[model samples]
Target: MTRSLHDRHRAVLPDWLALYYREPIEITHGEGRHVWDASGKKYLDFFGGILTTMTAHALPEVTKAVAEQAGRIIHSSTLYLDRPMVELAERIAQLSGIPDARVFFTTSGTEANDTALLLATAHRRSSQILAMRNSYHGRSFSAVGITGNRSWSPTGLSPLQTLYVHGGVRTRGPYAHLSDARFIEACVADLEDLLGHTRDVAALIAEPIQGVGGFTSPPDGLYAAFREVLNRHGILWITDEVQTGWGRTGDHFWGWQAHADSGPPDILTFAKGIGNGMSIGGVVARADVMNCLDSNSISTFGGSPVTMAAGLANLGHLLEHDLQGNARRVGGLLIERLRAIGAQLPIVREVRGRGLMAGIELVRPGTDEADPQAAAAVLEAAREGGLLIGKGGGHDTSVLRVAPPLSLTVAEAEEGAAILERALRAV
Candidate 1:
């Protein structure tokens, strides 16, 4: 059965589209923190479908909202009034720290970020963008232009002229030797130096935690320091919160809040979790920046009543249950446990990230070279043990990514860790 399906998928899907595992299993259904494949094999889903499942599989609130909305109306383009869209926007506006915020919904994070690029360029009157090294925004032409990860970027041709800066990855880079204070200062100085060479820089877009770049994060106050510099040039600060939003980070509702000393970002983008399994993404900005374009535009599917209903229900459930607190408590334990696990294994060079998002970077024992082979071995081993994980890094893809639902239980976490430990030991 798997062989026939694999052959069909290869014939239909693009070659570049990635699939996990040497023997990829088709997920048929999921409930709570577990999912079953076509072979009726169950696995603890730590990656949460690339962190899109913010709450849980088949969450009652989101399922009910989606069903009811579908029963009434599945879609109504932006030409008409949408009560669910308006209500969700109002809630997001209040939660978004931007003053006089405005929300524009899109179907995916890629579109949301593409909209952000349009707004930033139009408002600042420039096409140059400042982005961090080893960062990923999206796959659109505009987004790929700003992404610093060469592995994910398909081509150099892009709409915006982007300058790569340092400081996203704390352990890897030129200033890796510096202490936390000096590292922040070095990155700020690098930004200032780069700014001196360029004119009318539109914005500096960064992920509070570099999601596809192996869940690495900068020092807590690094962005606030850059904000102090960007403010002087009237350049915008756009935070890509697609993978880092909705209290998944444990300590904050949004990852950028870790650097909230200078206040909120000029523009913010989010997706991949707000609607649970439903597709929902959006850009939030102050009125002046969002209203810069003169031409009228509307997404055919963006902010459709159905998706908005899911978003509203999902957000309500997240906030009401205080899943952020659970993430902080449970995730802290998971990280501590992983660190201890890593310490005993020579393959694990480092264990990084906060909250429920964690990464274990593998390296050749007694060396600095990345060990992608070892990562692949562990991935297959873990799967055989009934655990599903993920992998990402700069170029070698050596970092193992583990991001479970915010509602993940301590017992499930322990079960996943035990499986991971055995896998690592085997590798």
Candidate 2:
């Protein structure tokens, strides 16, 4: 059944849209942290649909909210005042650390990022942007221009001229040999020096944790240090929290909180997981920055009633249950277990992540070279073992991405870890 569907998908879908596994299975349904394929094979989902499933599959709260909202009204566009939209925005504005924050809704992380770029460039009156190496922002033309990952970037043409910065990846860069303090110093020096050669850089956009770049994160206070320098030039800081937001990163509610010394970013973009598979993405910025645009703009489907209802329900459940605390406690244990599994494996280079998000980078046995082939083998093996995972990294997709739902239980984590261990061994 999946084979014929795959053939149809290949015939119609864009070739660039990649699918997982050699023989990709059709996910017919899911409950909690597990999903079933068309063949009725049950598998533990570790990747959470590329971390979009923030809460859980078939979550009752989100499903009920969506159903009720759809029954009333699915969409009214931005021309009408929406109660659910207003409520979710209010909650987000309060949660976003930006004072006097304004929220703008979009349909996906790509749109959220595009809106951020538009706001930054318009407010600062410059098309120049500073991005980090090994970062993955989104797929929009504006987003691709700023993205530092070659694998994800499909075009050189972009509306903004972006400069790539260091310090996104901690273990495999020029400053990899340095202590965390020294590494931050070097990256800061690079930023300062780069600024000297450029002018009117609107904003420096970074993913608190480089999601598609194998969940790599810099030192805790690196961004805060960078914030000090950006402050000197009046450059805005934009944090992409699409994957790392909403307590996914165990230790902090938002990934930027890890570098909270400088307070929050000037602009924040988020999508994926907030709606628990519902399409919801948004940007929060200081009122001045958000209102800088002279003309009106509205997303036709952005703040639709149904999506907003999902967001409201999802966010409510997340906070009420203290899922952030759960992420911290459970994610810590998962990471420790993964590190133990990696210790004895020659193919495993490093295990890094915080909260429910973790990455295991694969390398050739006896060398430091990235082993993309090994990653593929493990992915296939994991699938055979009834486990679903994801792979991502730089040019070579050599890292195994393990990000289950925020509500993932301790037993689920252990089960997934055991399956992953066997998969790793098989590969």
Candidate 3:
């Protein structure tokens, strides 16, 4: 008899490659917000492949664009002029909100962030960087160097000297009990104090809304406050929008827009949702910072025509349908529903997030300590109830992640929430 797929996977893959459940699933196909496993069980896909499926699954517009472009030309390396690459870059640059913005394509968020660090360090002539605590950038060596989340960071050695700052997480930090305004002030003061101890900081890279840190975010205008301080010292600000871009957050097109008083970041990096599941990542920076590199560099498959075409079509569809507004309306109702459900359950310490990206923090009943076991139970129970969600947090993995496609409907949201309620109660 042939061995099972899971058995084969375990035999070949490294132990560090984590799977979701005790009996991991093999997602076979998807349509809209629902997907089917290899065993033919349908699941309401709330996680959306870690929020990469910004638009609906199997979107016709993106699929057609990818097919058409692949039929014409698939791979034209950056050595020659590429029309799709230029067109997509132009659109992204115009939308990035940075003055005289330049866009460089990459294959993943890890590479996109790596490029951002390179630009900042080279432009400022410093290897020191500032990153927020409990942040998750990407898995690349450089990206992990700046990532403050120790769980995801595998090694301590890094090319850039990284300093961790406070204020990325709200409800669990030393200043969590403060009012929103006071909390912002405290975090800003903390940032200023951190800068005092260190010099030659090339940049302060932040997620605006920490994705892997359980959807935690400081008060509104926190970054703007930090920007005022960074501006004084000529430190560049880099916004990592890998999980928050393309209207996933509902209220703002980019997560950084929530802190609009500071204007756009000096450098911005994006990935995950722009291609609607295709591997399209990029860095958008002002001309001065982007042009700082003395030598030439290029990504062979970064701006491949097929992926650029997919990005163009996916972005066009997202804007044409006004999915951002849809996210706002539907996501508001979902969050309120989650809060109602959470209020009844002591295991749910918090229900937090903006737009479609939500997190339900699990804790032991009658205690403030994190309950990762409860989180795992809820995840498995939700899967059994025909729902698919994700889990993440600082280090314990105690937060249930609920980030559906931006096009999620009110009915779908309600259905998913109901299933999640059952899962939470069951746990």
Global fold similarity of model 3 (TM-score): 0.99
Give the distance in Å from residue 402's predicted Cα in candidate 2 to where it truly belongs.
0.3
Off by over 4 Å in 2: 1-3
Query: What is the lDDT for 125 in model 2?
Result: 98
Instruction: Give the clashing pairs for model 1.
Output: none
Cα deviation at 234, candidate 1, in Å, is: 0.4
lDDT of 3 by residue, 1-427 (tens): 9999999999999999989999999999999999999999999999989999889899999999999999999898999899999999999999999999999999999999999999999999999999999999999889989989899999999999999988999898799899999999998899889989989899999998899988999888999999999999999999999999988899999999999999999999999999989999999999999999999887899999999999999999999999999889999999999999999999989999999999999999999999899999999999999999999999899999999999999999999999999999998
Residue 246 error for model 1, in Å? 0.4
lDDT of 2: 0.95
Q: In model 1, how large is the Cα lDDT of residue 251?
A: 98
Once superposed on the true structure, which residue ranges of model 1 sit more than 4 Å away at CA? 1-3
Q: For residues 316-335, what per-residue lDDT tens digits would candidate 2 score against the true structure?
A: 99999999999999999999
What pairs collide in candidate 3? none
Worst 10 residues of 2 by lDDT: 1-10
- Tens-place lDDT digits, model 1, residues 1-427: 4558888999999999999988778999999999999999999999988899989999999999999999999988999999999999999999999999999999999999999999999999899999989999988999999999999999999989999999999998789999999999999999999998989999999999999999999999999999999999999999999999999999999999999997999999999989887899999999999999989888899999999999999999999999999999999999999999999999999999899999999999999899999999999999999999999898888999999999999999999999999999999
- Which of 2 and 3 is the better model by lDDT? 2
- Give the local distance difference test score of model 3: 0.94
- The CA lDDT at 74 in model 2 is 86
